[model samples]
Target: MEELVLYGTLAAAGASGPRNPQKMKSGQQNHNNSSIVVCDLHSGTPYQTFKNVSLPRGSTLQAVHATSDRVFSVQHNSSVLLVYHWGRDSAVQTIVLPEKLAVVKVSPSGNWLIGGAQTGRIYIWEVMSGNLVAVREKHYQEVTVIEFGRDDDSFVFTGSKDSTVLGWRLYDLVNSGECQPVYSWNKVHSLEITGVRLGYGLRNVYTSSLDNTLRCWDLERNELVSTYILPEKIKAIAMDPSERAVYAGLINGDIIIVNRYKLNPTTGMVEGPKGNNEKVTLTYQDNSDILLTRPDSDTKASVTCLDISFDGTVLAAGYSDGQAYTWDITTKQVLRKLAPQKEAVSSIQIVSRSRKVIPGGIKLTGNNSNMLAKKKNDTSAEIFKLPIFKRILDEKEIENHNVWVKLADAPKQEVDDLAQVKVKMAKFLHEPRFIASAKVSKSNVAALTGRVKELEAQLQRAKDLKQAKEMM
Candidate 1:
């Protein structure tokens, strides 16, 4: 397998990608190798093929910091995703996952995408193509959540409503034409999974279940390492850039911040020997600390979607009431907001990609409308001086910022409740049977301990109002 490794990395990555379409034409190339599709959001909406694709091209996002009268943020730009336009007011892809999209992760380099479908299938898509690159159906009840291991191996791991979290090598799933579970939990959770996220570098897997708690697993050892009990059912989970503690959003509109008390991210290890596999240590305790938060400070709005930029400059939360707000992570204050949709946001991502808009550059000529002409008439009428024509053009331009997405109405899970669900899964991890299964390496365990301290410092800065910035 390693023999062809050089070929996969160096040769086809660029330069010869399209011309040597020989591999794709042969139909034998694994979907894992490539998936490429592009769309024009405006003119080709109805005729587009892929249903799950959408792009934010040519559209302007409502600037959250702007006034209501401003038109730039009202409409969006054209995107390559599947766009079904019933009219001017309609153009968003809708997909109903078999269960709920437990976890939707776009690859770091943007080559591939992965998400767990409610049908207990691990859905893999090619990024630009919006194609179902591959599908791994291995779960029984439903695939509640999934994460791609952040290691060089690039494996896929999933947590299920059946109370199980299983790991699999990606290439194995691609070549074997079937999903073979590496680890299975007869009872991973008492309820459904609502929140889940893989650790930054794949040292751990964290999940929140309907059972009202969060669970952290040691993937290498296949054991439950620690658990966190939140104030309410966990709804969303986002790790700090440092991977210290995670900010979990709950159904009750509260976010619980779980601290490692002692763990490390850099080395992927726990400091103390806090385990049950013939191991004993001082901090046998689980969950160093849990802090409650409200991703959305508004009293009435429930968070529908949440995302943090890679640099942690913006923390955006989409509401069930059809509003999206950006907050200052450091100061914890709302910087800008938009009420764009009437429906809850199925997903929210602080993507760096943006649509480009070019104006028509048309000029208007009128008898009674021009302010420049009024001065020439010697009547100097200030009543007709409002630059009405220019305003009309401005509004026309504002409402026309046609934003398009690349995904279509293809089915997937509704991960809207993920953060809260992982919290419940935490309890199951705390269970003795599960604890006995974890592989806590001395270095792995020690690494986790150190990362905890590093993350604590970051979270403290985020909580202390020393952080939070406006996003572009």
Candidate 2:
């Protein structure tokens, strides 16, 4: 099996003081721990860390996303975005935003970056051009989660504290300048949504809320498919790649695995879980079928984030206590426990190792010596660097922008002039004038054939006459 890595972010120590009084006193200055831990998922040992020295002293909630070559993170309670290269320990670039973002997500193609702000406004930026394409506000409360569809970057789903989930088409935002959402579901959850995940082909969506319920929505029909009511408030949720199971992280340090399909006893066919309201209550007793408790059960730490591997065999869970755990999906047991951070673990992601490679098949060795030397030697190359993001969309710049497309030469093919003529003739056959002309040509051909036959007969008679004259 290929080794998987986990990227985790820790919240500021005093950021959650108002929410949890036991952690810290209210009105305390939030301490910044602007670092991301990259660890081996199987062994739970960290090998690399990325830090930003210039970020303000604050927290980072679930605002971390990584691409093939870079990691994007936002400074919670501040209007700062940090972009880091995999090989660099420090951030490569720091972007200052106009407003504080609650969550940020990168599109699957890495061509677009979007952030949901505390004011319920969503901003999108084109990665290569660094142009702000769209900035729209539709939610009434703070945006909590932003998720692009699985393997599909054209569609985005956003959940807010107003208990509404809206889906937007990326093309409309970028090209048409229409910031309206394609679909909006407002009455599904009564409380604020915490997590949002899309199913395969973007057909279904799964969301968890603080209302103690996990709801599934069918995007094709725009209707609610199923709702599972849990005992505790659901804080985080992750779905497997195959969509066979859903893992919900609760506030009480418990993880609930709800199987979407179960075998029927009579027909042996896979069917959904059957019950009125789908009420699933967690207990400490012998019902180990769906519950996975934290190792330190005595301590009540909320599960802040959850992510599953691409293969769906491993699950990574992050807690408010700054601890991270890896679990085996088949056995429902803890595979490894990572070292705790100084504060709460705000976000966790399970990604493959291949994503760490740079564009030129060069794996990042975490050595900045070569980069420093290259930068010092080549000042002209800096001119081609990506432009800084603009705060507002520039209509004049867009009108003057030019797009260049490199088209490959098509393969050479031999052309038949007679075939071309025949095709042209075939196309005109349906015309009235052509039809009449075709009939005239056919009659003329028949008359010419008859004339040729008559001439041949006359020629034979002449030969016979010449033979007779010669005999006489």
Candidate 3:
């Protein structure tokens, strides 16, 4: 062993030392431990329970909505749009949809909102005005779905189980009467118009049906572009932004992605084996073909409503049960499962634009900061909901803090660094004394900032997961 090590080390270590240690940047040091951040936006697991119904008992809870700040559970009733908050363990703003509120959408510009409900009704409301500007009840069977066009708000499309697809001019809405039918096909589905979507860049509308066929519609010429049949009835349809492929989530526990890829010169039809098995293919793009199936379980289901982000990075599926799953399209990995809905998601939309603020500016720490103010609210009235355990928590938390400080005291670099930060941070906690002293100082600021960020991220992730479970 020594001879072998000597030979290899001499041959490889030529100039530098034998140990290939990683260098620590001045302010970029980090812990060796790995951590995960589960977002309600993607594939985090949720905890759920239900009263038995029938064979598909646990799966009926599926309402999903995606907006700029939140991914949510949709409302079937005229009640209110649910904005699920991963941090609050509850929902915010149960938005009342205009009219009877069948379908709702925040425009691509994030300025206007449109709500379409039963009996061919539509309402356009400006969020800033918090008031409805116009109402058009033009449909025949309750607006079933709504899709906002990209790049411009010039036009939007709607599909109804009434077996019709309509494209309305956003600019000429007032003068536009008897809304023009971009495309209409009653033969697309016999049961109910399940889903309709415009293909990316194709100017053609795609429609899916309870009858199990996905048909493309050319609104301008009023024609059916093409039709592809699935193994079973259809539940959801999503077209990737590239327009080369489309995914039809089925009632057969299968996600069938069809590529507009033609196998032969004259044949435009593309086909693959159908089953509850897992499959992935590379055709339309990197994440072209994918098949989703429930694992070995007592429950089986068909996805009710599903959506994929524009870039095809995030894919979400809402089940008949009040549940939603977000998937990493390329890796075929589940990222975070939004909490399950109490009922099946009538629809689901994803907000594609998300960003991290570019370190806005210099952060000024001082005594008057919010960190100091939160320390003052240490009352049973403020801390507890029920009267029984309020005092007990205050006393226990106080003791716990002292115990933690003592336990963390040590001579090791990490331990010492942590202990010092702990004491300072304790002074800035929910209840503390001399909160001003806890303000961050520039000295060793990077280390402290990284540590604080790490802790906050970990805590936020845990909080998001817990909320997701309760929401389910």
For all predicted structures, in order, the TM-scores are 0.47, 0.73, 0.53
| Candidate 2 off by > 4 Å | 1-4, 10-31, 53-61, 176-178, 273-286, 355-385, 402-472
Expressed as tens digits, the lDDT of each residue in 1-472 for candidate 3 is: 0000000000011122112112311112122111111233532432111111111111111224344443333333233444332222233233434333455566667556666666667666544334444566556776677776766676777766576666777655423245553434544456566676665453767777777777766666666556676767887788877776787888755676676653554666564333222233332234324565544223565677777776676776766554566766676656665654444444455544434211211122232211111113332111111001011113333234221111222445555787889987876685544566667778779998899999999999999999999999
Tell me how many clashing residue pairs each candidate has: 97, 0, 25
- lDDT digits (tens) for residues 41-133 of candidate 2: 888777567764222222223578876556777764456676666555565555666676778888988778898888889888877666787
Model 1 is weakest, by summed lDDT over 10 consecutive residues, at 1-10
* Tens-digit per-residue lDDT, 1-472, candidate 1: 0000000001112222122222221112122211111122111122112111222111011111100111001101110111122111221222222223334544554445565544566666543333444567777765545556433447666666676667777666544255676766557677766555676667777776767677777778888877666546665666666666666666656545555545578887766425432221212145333433344456665554455656654566555455555555666556555434433443444433223221122122253222221223333221111111110113333344322223323566666567558966987889888888885779998899999999999899887664445331
lDDT of each: 0.44, 0.72, 0.49
Models sorted by lDDT, best on top? 2, 3, 1
Ranking by TM-score: 2, 3, 1
- Deviating ranges (above 4 Å) for candidate 3: 1-64, 70-99, 174-189, 265-290, 326-347, 353-472
**CA shift of 292, model 1, Å:** 6.3
Model 1 CA deviation exceeding 4 Å by range: 1-105, 113-116, 123-134, 149-153, 262-301, 354-472
Candidate with best TM-score: 2
